[model samples]
Target: MDAGGEEAKQERHLVLAHKLFLLSHPDLDDLAKVALRSDALDAVKSDGMAPLFESLAAAGVLEPDDALLAEMRARIDEEVRKLDEKIADAEENLGESEVREAHLAKSLYFMRVGEKEKALEQLKVTEGKTVAVGQKMDLVFYTLQIGLFYMDFDLISKSIDKAKNLFEEGGDWERKNRLKVYEGLYFMATRNFKKAASLFLDSISTFTTYELFPYDTFVFYTVITSIITLDRVSLKQKVVDAPEILAVIGKVPHLSEFLNSLYNCQYKSFFVAFSGMTEQIKLDRYLQPHFRYYMREVRTVVYSQFLESYKSVTMEAMAAAFGVTVDFIDQELSRFIAAGKLHCKIDKVAGVLETNRPDARNAFYQATIKQGDFLLNRIQKLSRVIDL
Candidate 1:
């Protein structure tokens, strides 16, 4: 790899290190220690990110070293001095573009050093000197990365809006596609799976946002968000049959089985895949927060799909289908039924589940009756107001 590629890889590993620290998995503890001690530490020292180093040290993710901290601070001061000189020289003897570049360099330096506030401030200064919409959008992308690194949703939200506004002033297709992935990530983190799924699907074929994550990670996010939000037909069309997903779905462990088994109506296989991948789900920084919710949604999807094919089914048969005990199936169905997630009623005495899915025509008719009653009440209140 070239110098740039090596630097990018190191930076990516640093981000991964941050994510690893956020995870609570015992299996990843040693891996986290290695990353912090090696690649992550090297990048932090090279960028003179004393703040990040100190934070990691305080969190006990890294060992505290006073001498190394002092050295990093000295390096940061020297680099800032040189950057300030470059800015002054450009302002005194060079053109507007040179001054802008100098300011941008300083901003990028602050970003590398993990100084979020300083980087944002310097970026605003650089943005003041920037003229092209595309260049301005690039600056927003930088801000978005900082937001993502820190998991600051407020900053991420503002940066996304800023990017969209810059696009309205005219932006390229590549940046636009990149922004979709960024926005998709934001929505996913915020638990808006429907919007996240839409944005992810839109960017599946056009994804080039490696700065956010690798292509495989992107595919994983796309599949995860799609399964819960999309109908069966849409899931089959967009994810199961799509060439982009098919090419890389197997790369992620148990993901292909989880997706395919659910779609194929293989209850036992789907259950196994789901159980096998819970660790993967729990390990993800973004998905970890919604892990339990996701588990419930997956069960809901599978149970609803299974019930759709039968008017009534024995609890023993259902338990056998899922490769679970009958008591477990009964309890699962009872909870889902009580919560209104499943459109079925369990008959414990008869040891059978009866599907009572609401009739679409009857539902619409009842909705119309409710609306008519509301309209009549509104007219009567209006008449009383007029009389008064």
Candidate 2:
């Protein structure tokens, strides 16, 4: 063989060996360390394995270096440029389908580098093209991902609707499960906690049946949203106590502690657990939208419990129990009272909040009105029947 052929063979062998090594070492960090030590990455560099390098960078197995990243990006850009030219040539000779595949591959590369806008532009080209069910699913997946990352609920909803039909028709169980997750995320974004929690729970079951990516993320959302939307008993029965969920919860200590506090009604403990992770919760893409609402719901539960336990509690004592200032407690109490959530009277001067149970007279009046409405409806129906 010529020297060029011999060099190509060596590069191919090196790439194969690298793949085998990665397969043997499941841990990306461990593989990265070994690959670096053995000069395996260097051997494969000649083959222009941009995707491999990109994966390493994404996995944090390769430390961040600005110059190195820029160089890699430049190389990938050059490769994409070449591919664009090939795609143009193939459009006439190869076929439209082949050209669409090229566009998708390029779009994927852009997506990996976080250039979602460019990826989206590429996806737009392939959107209405005739493609296989699997390719159609890929299109839908990327569309939803772009919509979600950008916080465009309309786009996300549209993508889900489009994919739902395809997945249902194709009977793609795995992708359908993924669609559930995206739907859950959409509901969460919209602040529909009940629907979001239910969808997450259903998705968790599907995930258990067929191992899915980002399993731990789904578990976190499921636990947090369930706490907000479900009572203690329902949460325990459906989520916290589930064996599959428990296994996943073991991986997230913060979530585990939060769940424990919520289940035990340890208000102070729950606050501490939640406050410690406040920044992380805010930064999470999926959790940020619901965090404030969840916190309010938790406080409502805690305050309601307090009201039930005591006929009247001083603002100072309430503040102390909740680890907040008296002024904060007063303000929250006023807001709750205004919203009719807390049936209580607040004495600003005395700094006491007096709980007011529903008056028996008011209950009787409400029941009487409800019964009168029912009787009126029955009489009208009977009159109509007699006329008939």
Candidate 3:
């Protein structure tokens, strides 16, 4: 990345962090206003975020400042003029690479100023001049950053596909690893935890995408997604014992205990860690919408793990094992059982829970049957096309 690209990446993260802070601290209006004016406005101004500025003003998050807006416009115009001059000179007298560099500089400028449509247009122009697979991938990465910053799923999805296609043409290992983080974040934001978990775990040791987030945040996502997606055995091996995760997991509050307690079957401690993790989840823009779903999934995992141990157990004993009251356990079990999330029956009269656990063979058979059905449908479609 060039200086402009690096600055653009940093500014993108800073702006996103500020917006996320405002989202999570709605009650602290005065503080938000101060932070916006003091810390964010300069960057916003440089980025020429007129719509964002007006939106904040309309929302009363910031007072309207005509002078700042004027200054922002003036600065943008001046910088764009210089870029055009450079591009024109390069086209007139310079070689192909110089012209390509000039065009890329202009594209990066548009990206830095948060001009999404212009940035994409200019990037396409730059891509037209680029021949190397690596350079094309870099362009895709820039597009991905813009998509992520704006939370534009369509753009993000398309960019990710484009990056993968370019990688097929040939890309370096570092860029490939970086793409995994980008794809993981997209999957996570789109509520596909299984795919996200796979991608995050793959990139854990090779995580160099600091522009997206820090190592701690990466580990946090890895742990959170793995807990819901990975089996206990895999979780123990990949997350609980992984050196990359072990190194930074403790830095994120409640996260270490959250992963370890569940793996260790310490239900009470797990619950405490889980409770602490929820506040952070609620504060996150991507995770907040899925909070209820995540809560249900985590509960299902823990409940299923507990029930896997025995054929039958007293309700009181199960409750005590989780450090909860008998009534609480009974209610929780009844809800999960009714929802078909847990394969157990509660014997209210005897205060015993009987597990109806499926055998491994049976589960595999069911999975095979479903897959066979899917394959048959696809084959029938192919036969029809052949007949036609």
Best by lDDT: 1
Evaluate model 3: give its TM-score: 0.87
Pairwise lDDT winner, candidates 2 and 3: 3
- TM-score each candidate: 0.90, 0.66, 0.87
Residues 1-388 of candidate 2 have per-residue lDDT tens digits of 1324333433233234334344344334664556553464453254444555566556764444556656766887797898798778778788887888777777776655456577788787776564678778878777776675456788888888888788766846777777787788788878887898998898776763121225665677788778778876788799878886887686665788778876776667877878865655564655565767667776676678677778888888878876778888888888888888788899988888898978799999999999999999999999999999
RMSD of each: 3.5, 10.9, 5.5
Q: Please, what are the lDDT tens digits per residue for candidate 1 over residues 28-82?
A: 6676656546766676777778998898889876679999999988888999999
Query: lDDT by residue for model 3 over 1-388, one digit each (tens)?
Result: 1334543555364455546455446544675557656666665665687656677667765679888767776777899899999999999999999999999999998887767799899999999999999999989988988887778899999999989888888899999999999999999999999999999999988988878866787789999999999998899899999998888788789999999999899999999999999988876767877989999999999999988998999998888888889999989888988999999998899999999977999989999999999999999999999999
Model 3 residue runs over 4 Å out of place are 1-11, 14-18, 24-38, 46-48, 362-388
* Candidate 2 pairs with clashing backbones: none
Clashes of 2: 0
Clashing pairs in 3: none
Cα deviation of 312, candidate 1, in Å = 1.4
Off by over 4 Å in 1: 1-14, 17-19, 22-37, 368-388
